[model samples]
Target: MARPVWSGTLTFGLVSLPVQMFTATDSHTVRFHQLQRGTSDRVRNKRVNERTGEEVPLDEVVKAFDDGDEYVLVEPEELDDIAPGRSRTLEITGFVDLRDVEPIFFDRTYFLGPKGKEYTKVYALLEKALGEAGAAGIATFVMRNHQYLVAVRAEAGLLTLHTLHWADEIRDPRREIDNLPGRTKVTDRELKMARQLVDTLRIDWKPEDFHDTYQERVTALIEAKRTGKSVEKAEPPAESTNVVDLMDALRASVDRAKKPSDQPSGHGGKKRANSGDTSPPTHIRDAAAKRRSGGGGRRKGGGAGSSKGASLDTLTKAELYRRATEASVPGRSSMNRGELVDALRGARQHRATS
Candidate 1:
């Protein structure tokens, strides 16, 4: 069992449960020390006085705040003196429906366990009450000199606390997003096909089913190198073509989803980070360049004189998203229709110029 990182009283009304907070998750990323290339010596970091060019002792290091032309040095003891409180307590402010909080606001999570055998009953009672009510308790607490907004809820048989970002910390999409969709319409048949595709591929989430293949490949590479073995290189996936119709792509995706797991869907396998290919694949760039050169063929039953540039502005949200996907626009998944159009147009122009 992991040791508790923090111990505090969880208070609500007249009830106070003495609990210990243990981190619920941990990163498994491999760590490497900085070293000089071709040398066995490891690099080290040091703190020094900027003006004097002298190494500064840890005890002598004081944090300073810039105030225009001068600086105010503050001692570590001064920070402790102005801390929230002497007694550590996570006081519940109010209960709220769990659905009210968006997933984006959540940060780190911790598990709450009874500090002593005597506190188990109260802890279980609180967990059960929150679980039955289908609600989470909003609370504020201080830890490591930082105040955190948190949501406490029941998970499995234990209480879990998720640290949340303050309301002011969340950026307003209206201000940050310039090209938001105005009014876009989707054909009933297209919408139906899209839903069918989603329904066909949907499955219960099993985290264990997915593994970090890149990390595994990296480990294998290191092992092979140590044993004096050369690893074979794998081919990259082909780039997607510019989509002329949304319904056609959705239909093809649905068919692929229905196919057996062993069969390939023409598209390449996911590119692993260990592959060391930083630039976008050649096929994607080529395809984007082709699209930018007015390679979009005439729509079925349409004349060759049809305006391809003007047609882009009249595309549905689904069609715009498909184009954005082909162009590999970052964060395109969350963008609105107009934003997708703007990004796709910019990507096309960039591909053409570059």
Candidate 2:
């Protein structure tokens, strides 16, 4: 095992156990440094003086703060001395039901384990207690010299600690968003149809069922570019679709979800005719074809012309993420789908380049 970055203890009045903190999470993808296109040699970066176009020595550089006009330079070493350090202990302040904590506050997750054989019993006790209570312990711990709020809870037989963002860090939705529908004047028939459609498509979260098709497409694009193959642009869907009478669409969607797709014939992806003139009704064909195109049309917000009725489920996860990147949605920097899903889709499409 590698050496821990910090050594600490979980203190909860009369119960203390030694613990160690290891660097959690890693970049699975390989990293590379920028270099000149023609050469394999490392491209060195020179420290250039901003005012004068000349190289500056590293030792002469100092930290500076700007007041939107002028900069006040301070000795770099002063920053180290002035900045306070976290006390380096996972001090439990209290416990709260895990459900009560909003998803916005969560930042990063880490695992906490007993430091030695002697501390195992106390560690197990804390884990069991938290698990039984269906609660998470709110604790403070120092990692990389900064104090952070962490939620310590038990999962998979180990104590897992999730670092949290401050409450003030989350932006208010009311500020950026305006002119949204209040009650959405949906008809009872439509609501019933929508509910029935949701039921037909319900399935367990089999993660394998989902894959980053965008990433796969991107990989294919990179390979095509490398091999000098023509990267054909996909045809865009028609300019528009109507949004009125969603109930009729919902009714069709329920039937589509319930019906199994026709078996494939030996003819490249063609459906074998169980019955003549049986081209899956127009709506079903459109929905399935959209899936094969990797939902390019949905990402562009043109759902066959229904400008006001774009849906997040209309696109795949990868398409949604691509739109999020293009839209430059806020906090998309750290959002996981379960929380960011439907909300982020519309947000990204409408958000400005802030």
Candidate 3:
């Protein structure tokens, strides 16, 4: 069973629906404690007074809210006193087009379902109504002593609640973009090549397709470090990637994006790391080149179809994943490699008809 982090009733108009909130995301960053170089003991964080150098207990900490221009220190109990509702309810004051709400307003998301099995009908009814209208229920629900601008929308077969950020929280892009020049006009040739490049690189966007590449590389690096491997520093890529001629560079980039088999593929390739979590693109290219030279083909005849068949069906799902790593497919760690063989097959068939 899943745990509810917050319990409250969702209220909009006369309808009051009970609900619970749970976290929608998790982090897997490796944690390390500060440790002395020669000792087995771990280091501890301490809060000490700068002047007196006295250690402070955790309970001694207090949050200070900025009141106007001054800092107003308040106690925990005081915050509890101001908790959003004496009677738990989400109040929907108004509704607006989803497009009207800028992306900056979105903060977090949570799944909202009927609080109990008894509210099943109500849940379905709400989900259906929201779906048909193509409208997100703009509502405010109090959770964890604070009120949140939450968008209630039905996804798949369930109610999903997305928490929105307050207007004050969003940084003004114009402030950072100050003094930016107006757009430069492009020639017909430049525009044509640019569009061609974009179309060539375009692919169906599935959130699961990509991953935290830097994280995976970092993890690999850490593992390599633990194994006592050394990493060499690399020279940087060309500083002036801006081309002398726009259309010519775009044409070159498009051709380079293709696979050696003459297939019009995107800018995706394998990479190799020096016993660390991070691998360089150049290293991956080098490895691929070396493999191609040592063995004429990974399959029979060096034909596209035969090579794909060998690559796809040569091994089980795990083997395909290994091959994909050899191919430098992104987000490999987050995948159940064996299951992907069936998935890729289905995806390919679907794409062919569509």
Q: Which stretches of candidate 3 lie over 4 Å from their true place?
A: 49-51, 65-71, 231-240, 258-354
Q: Sort every candidate by TM-score, greatest first.
A: 1, 3, 2
Give per-residue CA lDDT, model 1, range 158-188, as digits (tens): 9999999999999998899988775767779
Q: Count the backbone clashes (under 3 Å) in each candidate.
A: 0, 5, 9
Model 3: per-residue Cα lDDT at residue 117: 91
Per-model TM against the reference: 0.70, 0.62, 0.68
- Candidate 1 lDDT: 0.71
* Candidate 3, 83-119: lDDT as tens digits: 6674267666665666677777887878776789987
What's the lDDT of the predicted structure labeled candidate 3?
Answer: 0.61
Which candidate leads the pack in TM-score? 1
Error of 2 at 284 (Å): 6.4
What tens-digit string does per-residue lDDT give for candidate 2 at 259-310?
4323221222322112111122345445545554676465354463222344
Query: What are the runs in model 1 whose C-alpha is more than 4 Å off?
Result: 177-184, 232-241, 261-354
Better of 1 and 2 by TM-score: 1
Residue pairs in collision within model 1: none
State each model's C-alpha RMSD to the native.
13.1, 14.1, 9.8
Off by over 4 Å in 2: 1-6, 23-47, 54-62, 67-86, 229-241, 260-354
lDDT of 2: 0.62
